[model samples]
Target: MTNLDIPATPGAAVARTEASPVGRVLAEQAVRTAAAWLAEFRKSPSTPAAYARDLGLAAVVEHHQLQDLVEAFPLPSVRTLFTRSRARGVAPELCWFPMLLDLGLHPVLDATPAHVKGWVALMDEHRDATGQPVLSPAARARRVAALSSLLRWAVTEELITANPVDRLDRDRAGLVVDRHHSPTRGLSGAQLDLLVWTADRYPGPQRARTAALVALLATTAIRVSELCGLATGDYFADTGRHVIEVTRKGGKRQRIPVPPAAAARLDAYLATRPDYGAVAVPGQHGAGRVPLLATTAWRPGAGRRGGGQPLSPGEVWATLRRVARTHPDLAHLADQLHPHQLRHSVATRLLEAGAPQQHVQDLLGHVDPAMTQRYNRARDQLHNSPTPLAGQLLERGLAALDQDQEHHPAG
Candidate 1:
């Protein structure tokens, strides 16, 4: 076997020769193929880079002799692939590499249709670090779809004769794997109230700031990352409505309307800061580049150097968790609650209160209506009542008995 030379950087171009190791050649070809496909498909910049890294790792694990590696690859599986991949900083999607490694299926030339179905079964029985099932049915389905895409690309390139994954009946797979729509669990009204109350009464030095942060999260449904990225200039009163301009996922800018109560809490929190009034111009209200949620680590001698640094997503999570841990009412949710749950809660609350699906979709900044529909379906299921149907049946049966007794004059 020839010694393999892996590139230090994924973006670096490598010159290949006829003498180059089979694994290296295969890896380079796969990356080139993926790049060409991505260019034509116009995928996000990060997609090609990630695929290059992942495929390169796959090449290394197989030692470049694709045919021999696939036939002899361990079936029951060990963590060797994962450990090696991590050392090279080429961690693929969770369980993706391991599943492939365990199957030892050749990507292009050798793997058969039965091998693909066997892989599906393996994923179904796989366990996580916590001893729970590794992938939910939906998650498994997504992973399969991703794998199928890659294989289909290989087939188009004529590297493979056919795409075996395409032969697997999707409807049959769905029947075998129970596909349930798992709704995002959000904080209930009581949970939200308790969280805010706890934050307000926190004895920590950053109590007021924490209170405001919780209030904003509960009301706005903005992601923690977006909240952390906010600048004071982003918050302003527009036409009698308090609004905050935020950059959502995928760099989309959105103006989210803040609730009056939450705005008041934010104002009170800002008033406690010495720089708030100084930063604002006399004519313009809420106009400054200062971070809306600045770090609490600033001290007098720090000389404003650390003052404007925004609270990180980790800090936001820790703050909420601290409040949940301290409050008796929220103690049960201490382990389960997080900032994203607040987003889910807001979405659910809006749908339950008769908000239009499209309006909620816009509020959440979801590009896909299907995602918004999940929230609507969950709300509908929650409110659907069996009592009405049961009540009608009972009433009809009782009325029939009453009429018979009256007509027969039973004594």
Candidate 2:
């Protein structure tokens, strides 16, 4: 059999040659193994290879002895699928896997919780040219979140059976922090309102799209990735509610009811285009295939007589920054305004309006309530505390009983 047909184990490959098995494969960068696996699977008539192959053999996988391509890579191959579009996001995270391999967790099967911790520690300790730590708390959080995402993808690809990142003590590992920093601060309530208003001042063509994009993000709090991934058909009537479906982090599709202002703006913007916003749902095909927030500048001369390319996350960032710069009122925010801050603004605004904490958590799609609770920096104020409100409610009942005794001489 050709070397191509042979499945090399770490020990076996080591025995065959005195080279470090991890360094050997990684030196060549293992792009060949990842590509070969993808090529073999892509040939399937039904595309079983699109998601399956020798994924099964990887499951006896947890206790470290690395398997062939099972431990080799779904990394570079999966990254290709995402990097095809800038909006797919997380390509930078995927880039980190090679560094992970360099740390001796070659097959991915070898990554344990301790290795994950050490990987993050290395990143945290690394210094940049400024002589400060390269990763801040927020940057460290992103690395952990990115690692979690990668490990989860590996699990789904069945490259390995268990996720070491999942077992991580997220808070202890410094991924979750109750402490708020300047980085976590979002726009003030008035600032959020000003942001949407700022969209109206977008210079030149397609102001309707600019307004709708800003309003939807400011009002609903969807991620920039979710906003960019939205298909025209994702907006549809659901039992009298105007709901928009978005692919959330990790490919989870969620439908959130659009508020009146966002819905009105979106509908008005959609009216300007050929599709009129009444596109088919994603699974239903072509009518819904166009981008919901397409940029007029993109593919201006191409495609159907109507639509343009979907906005990338970078485009969304620029749009917000541009809108902020347009108005004197938003000048201070021009440099710092971003799509994520809009999302953060939405969550905080909802909480400040006395919306239930649980509802806010659900609205923001946070799996951990702690993540949601971290947004309310003012929640501890006794003046605004719900406990006093409860006591006041009881006082009204006591007052009523006192009135009854005065009127009827009740015991």
Candidate 3:
């Protein structure tokens, strides 16, 4: 073979390190390095990391860095981060949470068995009245999505080289298609009349206030938060029509024209409005004034007050529940009624009344015209049922047959 050189085989001599567990320890260290980087990235964002979060977890989640993100970003703990991501406003979840800890990251990414167990325990505590998990099929999906977001945030922060949750079957983890039928199911006309009559059954300021709150929800379709968030300034009376401006989700604002009945009730309530420091600025007028809803709980500059102060969401819900129990007509409607249902009811009624789609969309502050179309389509089904018309035609056809029978008298 003379001086011919031989090419070395790929695995000819694998270098064997005599150091026991050296390879394992190095791999472990690499994982921890990635995890620590991820944690910092979540608090502080980077372009590549953010892109990973967007692509891997959720579409709505925007990247935020520790420097740029709010100090009170509300990402306090892992649980809170999950909850805020899932619950705040009507945003969708990212899909990377279910398994991100599997990748090597330090701190946030290190999957302690205790952490998983604690999450499962906490989730179990969120059951509804029926004791079925309140984090229903839909909610579980949202939770998973939220988890995915945090993991993706980890990736964005460079905690790991790849998204651990990238292949997580979000659909299997309860993130399924949401088909929401409006649960407006408000009081029927007669039922509403009965509720009013029941309200009238009580006397004095208590009756007035209760009636006003009920009327406000039913008529304005304002959210419970917006209703409770109200200050005297929210209502405008002098301009031929009364208008109440409500702050909705996403910090969006909408001005709803209140009917005379609700306006009258609101006026009555305002006349008795106590000084929770929620007065209207006389000359300025409309929408930009203080919050329409206020409670003594959040009194201006008051140190702190608990339940002794004015109403909270729970307080308002409880009070409304009590009112429902008092009235037979409203009793059935009470348990089902929420402040949001009032908004849905208003949207439904408006669409039913042939209100313009654009008008409804604007009134509801829907970001998309398609949302208004949904209500319009539903309203059409309610008022314009073809089945009923078909039934009437069938009856008329039978009547003609009856006349022929009388003429022929065939056995």
Candidate 4:
């Protein structure tokens, strides 16, 4: 039996634990090693909460009987699972944690193939309070993939004899199927037009800003994260085209060309700033720190001032929702509209307009051309639908037959 001391904080009494060498040994060294790895995996403050949660789970498993923990684990209520499933725009990592915690299957040496199969079955049987399936097929596959990776790592470290998850058939696990052929997710042309129109006329302090944001999103197709991260210095005129430099997902910086209409709206909105666009200029010393879409700052007597701070991603999402709800024309889309959908709409529109596949891929900052190809194929299918063409042909043939009968007096 090894004694492990886990300190809550500096100068605090250490919490001591004694490991049992029986079923599913939760080795202290393994916990310590995983903790160190997870700490190093922390990319930003935004990510530490998740790492801490993972570490906490490891701690819980360390102090408990593995079989007892699995059997007595309090699974998340069906209502809670449904609530999480209904949420839009949740981070993928965040979505996996609760489900993983509910399973209560800790990584340990004694964890067997049968145990893993049981866990998978439990997931398959999970239903919402209303008796609807909680996890979609794609979502189930994603959870399994995340678990498989973790178990594969444990196997490599000799913590487990084999990965039980690897033994599960891919198709049975809801993986390796044609799940990608689902309907295209984006606003139609009319919905998009109404959305922009509403934003342009939105009655509030955020009117101009919202309008500019909509135009920029529709044209540039930048991710919401990249859009929120834009500083004053990020936009500039290059040659005859207006360009905005953005750090895309995975830390790759790229310059995206802004359409003339979007660029004009953005410029007009910037000009209305209290600083007259001076704050957004890159080389203007302290002014370069100004956010392109700044949050409103309220003071005791200063009323409201814009351009003090950058808008958070949540704030951006809320703003779009607010605009959708406020405008009668866009009310139908209030629940469905989101920033990423704008990205999808742009990709689809560009592909339909005959833009080269590689160019569309670059515009969307996609690393894989295969993703862009999906959009292209969807556009082709929409245009080449036989139903509409067949209708047109039938109409023409009927008109010709009517004309012949009229000329020949067919009585």
Candidate 5:
């Protein structure tokens, strides 16, 4: 490894060129911080490897993933590679994160342009036994973005003045990763209606629960993990409005306002559930607050008095699949539909209705304004929807307003 002396105060000439030392402890801390950052910025729509190609949250994520190539590289030589001890991913949301995180033995400094170029060359040339390619071009791009992310964060904390990775990123070709325009694919309002309607008509005690689940999935747009975390005690209602107190990813609870229709569905479901703090009994979630939604298997155990347990994520998916399967129109989606897709569907609807991007971002817990803009842009470029018709309506409305002003001659 080549050592580049880092100046105490990096001058303008060496600002983006200097290399500062990063000890094993700092590298490990960076991984933890990077993970928290990714979770907070997960809703950002841009791909760090492709679109931004610079220091950003996505860039951190994309770059950090490569830090864990520990199996391929030893910890002592490449301390910069975050060896993750043995955990594959830092969080469940990002299981794809390479498990190569560790508090390595040496110090890692800020990457220089030469360092980035060297890393790229290694990725391109290095191959496992049998000459099989290890990191694909796309994978390499992701890790580069990941590295950029860490350096960018380092810069933010004033740990580094600039991210040298930016210098080499411009020279690299085919560094961009292929990305889907919209992960929702496109959830039309009609299909969303069918999803809710199908669940609503379910002929069982859990019918209301399923209906509420689908409705809230589309309307509230909470993550499935958060949905499953809901307890009977979480639903807060007042004379003015109804809201669900959702436990966010880090156990931070936030009250998300629910529309009247969805709230009504929730009430209908709770009408059949056991009271909060149901009597002590086995199979109950915690012998505490009952789950807002329960599985059919969670019957009245022993004396039919126990509070049913929270519905598992698997159960939620099963219910969604059942809803899709029951409706012939939605049958094709049975294998493809997921709860998160509905969240996207909600964003689409909100943007289509001309809601402010910031308001929508707040509603969805998106930290980046770029994601909100992407959602609007996706809706704007819709070829399937009646965008042309809407344009025609606008033109006609403007002309009608002009004629009315001329005829009426308002004072």
Candidate 6:
């Protein structure tokens, strides 16, 4: 391998020594640090303390990955090493792994613009392979977010001093990722009545209970995950205000306020709740707290004396399916329905009603107002219950174009 000199960078100077063995050890440390930091960031959200630790780790990983490249080939800089490593079938996420190996043998790897582009290409490949571009808008946003977090870590570690992914530019492509448009898809006046009627047929104690769950999701716009996480004790019975505490993706908690109608549904569900067993302690809201939803198959066991354990989110889907199957009219509507669609339905209704963007953001636990605005946009594009008139118009336009082509006779 050619001897590579570490360029002087103010206070940060790479030591160039003849001792290749010692240099290799340093590179290994760098690789380990990068992996450790990435793992830590995955476990924790973007906090000052978390970023600090990740920065230290990024430095280690970048050094090692670069060292491995230098030791294997006559690479002059970190950028060349990254290119050579990528050509050897190394993915972007695993770029640190190879870079760390190279750094263990050298002082520092030179990261260049060309090499950074190569890294970005690798990231794009991995993203496409893992169903990012082709997935739902929500899923695509989530994947981009995950990749951004790792790239940010690289920035703090001074691996490349800048996030290359941030430099990726996109042109006008129909709709931006995070932007919300008002949706035309919502239950019509008659369909809404049908849904309520079907939900009401759940039989006895299950009647009001099941209908309430669906109604609350539509009216309150709370996430289905948050709905399932609720406990019977989450409500203030006397005040008639139900507070739902939700833990979002990054372990951030947002408390959503439930309306009076939702509160009444919850109260009704609580009233009909069968006596599973005794309360372990007074006002312990955690595990010992009464489960908000339980199944008929639920039974008391070793630590669980309650009649039913807390219902999993899957139960929510099953309950909806059961109600849909029981009612013919509702079956047509509910067959293609998902819990999140109900959330979209509610958000659309609220935005149409002229609710404040900030209020919607707070209610939906969205980190940004832009995200909450997509629903608003989607709502405007279509009315409540998209009519077939637009479809008919599209067909007529296509027919007219075909007739014009026949008369023109291009051949």
- Best-to-worst ranking by TM-score: 2, 4, 1, 3, 6, 5
Local accuracy of candidate 1 as per-residue lDDT tens digits, 184-280 = 5777755666677667778867888988998888776677767876877778765556677776544445666676557777998898877665343
Candidate 2 differs from the real structure by a C-alpha RMSD in angstroms, to one decimal, of 14.5
Q: Which runs in model 1 stand beyond 4 Å of their true positions?
A: 1-123, 128-131, 138-181, 271-291, 296-314, 367-370, 373-411
Better of 1 and 3 by TM-score: 1
Estimate the TM-score of every prediction. Answer: 0.54, 0.61, 0.53, 0.59, 0.49, 0.50
RMSD of 6: 15.8
- Candidate 5 segments exceeding 4 Å error: 1-181, 249-252, 277-289, 296-307, 373-411
| Residue 235, candidate 2: alpha-carbon lDDT | 84
Q: What's the candidate order when arranged by decreasing lDDT? A: 1, 2, 4, 5, 6, 3
Report the Cα RMSD per candidate: 15.7, 14.5, 16.6, 13.7, 15.2, 15.8
Instruction: Please give the TM-score that candidate 3 achieves against the real structure.
Output: 0.53
Candidate 2 per-residue lDDT, tens place, 328-358, comes to 7788888877888877776766677676776
Q: Write the per-residue lDDT of candidate 6 for residues 1-411, one digit (tens) a residue.
A: 211222333332344343555554665544444344434533122232223222232333343445443333221122222322232212323343233233232212343334334433433344465576433333333333444565566668775576644654422211235455533355543344344445655765467668778656655566665676556554442233345544444545544555554556666766666642333222334435555665444332213323455554455776677776776666776656667666665655556656566566556656656777543121211112221221222234435545765899546
Stretches of candidate 3 above 4 Å error?
Answer: 1-131, 142-167, 183-186, 200-205, 237-239, 274-279, 282-310, 373-411
lDDT of 4 by residue, 1-411 (tens): 211111122222222334334222323333333443334332222222223232234333423433233333222111112222223333322332322222332344334556456545655666679996565665556556645655666777777668867778868665663533533478765556556656777897667888888777766677776787677787886555666777554345566666665676788788777744553343332323566777666522323334366665556787788889986667777776778787777667656656666666666655656766433121112222222222233234435545765899535
Clashes of each: 1, 0, 21, 0, 16, 39
- Backbone clashes in model 1, listed as residue pairs: 23-64
Give the residue spans of candidate 2 off by over 4 A: 1-95, 100-118, 127-132, 145-176, 179-183, 249-252, 275-288, 297-307, 374-411
lDDT of 6: 0.46
How displaced is residue 377 in candidate 6, in Å?
A: 16
lDDT of each: 0.56, 0.56, 0.44, 0.53, 0.52, 0.46
